[model samples]
Target: MKLKPVRFIFFCCFPLSVLIFLSAVTKKKPVKEALNEPGDGILLIKNTNGPTLGYSNKSGIKILSIENLYFKDLNKNGKLDKYEDWRLPVDERAKDLSSKLSTQQIAGLMLYSAHQAIPVLTGPFGGGTYNGQPFSAGEALASDVTDQQKDFLLKDNLRHVLLTSVQSPEIAARWNNNMQALVEGQGFGIPANNSSDPRHSTNGGVEYTAGAGGKI
Candidate 1:
């Protein structure tokens, strides 16, 4: 006779669903505002040093935590707030966006941000002339051109040749667009393509066309 022992059966239930709901509620925090008036009394984040792209303020500037910021719909997708919603490192963000944007869009954005002129072409001869000034190592970061290409331009003084022949036609078109913007003064300088000198009132005055197409 074989005797078999009965196995005990048990049902175990966990409150995992409740835990997850509670965790989300606990983690949610409010977005922060970028600027504050004295009456607002928002938490004052200590002034952190930043890149001096513009004229520096003698008095150090204060920052606020992200939690104190205003929430606005950015994408219009109904999502609340975004990393771009705050005033932070837009340059890095632009680079990030560039990775996702079309090449033309990236080029456009580069020109839009360039306060100084950006060269579309530099060559011994062309519609535009090469200044022959070597591209700075750091300046490459602010431009659409690559280090190798910039190096080639400096070595040969044939930047326009490269722009017309080497880079993809699509990119070249965008680069041209940026140049046009600079020439028109929409992207750089006041008077938008006119000379600052009161003596010359002509459009795209001497200064505007000085280095244009790489003239000496």
Candidate 2:
């Protein structure tokens, strides 16, 4: 049987619904507000190991503070579920999440988006359009979301994306943040996993072939 994400309804005077979020990792328990940028989609908490955890505010994801530790609420059910707890085995968490997804979501999970270029273009390789026009037809950033990207993401429900082009590190970072925020407000708040072909170049522990004059 297909499973559905748990959603809640608030009977406030204006009928308000709350989104939940959780920090992927956190340091000591939060005694006071260390970071506060409430309306922005995601919140960042400092990790003891030096990396910050980001969670969306609109997606109903929040950081649960325990005896000084922070946690992520991946399913956004107002509490930290098994899948949200990083301390557990990843396989266990994945199984829990897998059981909560609907059939459509599972189909979406199976789909893989084609090669995409950040700030899509009108070129020969990995070219795309803005709205219906080329990226340069008007002033569009390399990080601007193209029409095809939106269609595949929402209509096709494809979460996996392969990025082929990036203008700079800064542009790529901004694009990633924007993409996460956009999808965070969507159906089940599952984040996209953007990837690219691995470019591996290693010459370590190689032997020289004197006959071919090559390193292997």
Please tell me which predicted candidate would have the highest TM-score against the true structure.
2
The residue-level lDDT of candidate 1 at 3 comes to: 27
Q: TM-scores for all candidates?
A: 0.23, 0.63
Off by over 4 Å in 2: 1-32, 36-42, 47-51, 56-60, 129-134, 137-139, 198-216
Model 1 regions more than 4 Å off: 1-21, 32-96, 112-216
Candidate 2, residues 1-216, lDDT tens digits: the string is 233322322234223222211332334466245454544355777656434567655456566775455676555667777777777898998898888888888898898887776766355656778778888787677667778887888777789987656767777777777778667667656788887654344332221111111111
lDDT against the true structure, per candidate, is 0.32, 0.65
The 10-residue segment with the lowest total lDDT in model 1? 187-196
At residue 168, give the lDDT of candidate 2: 70
How high a TM-score does candidate 1 get?
A: 0.23
Backbone clashes for every candidate come to 14, 12
Worst 10 residues of 2 by lDDT: 207-216
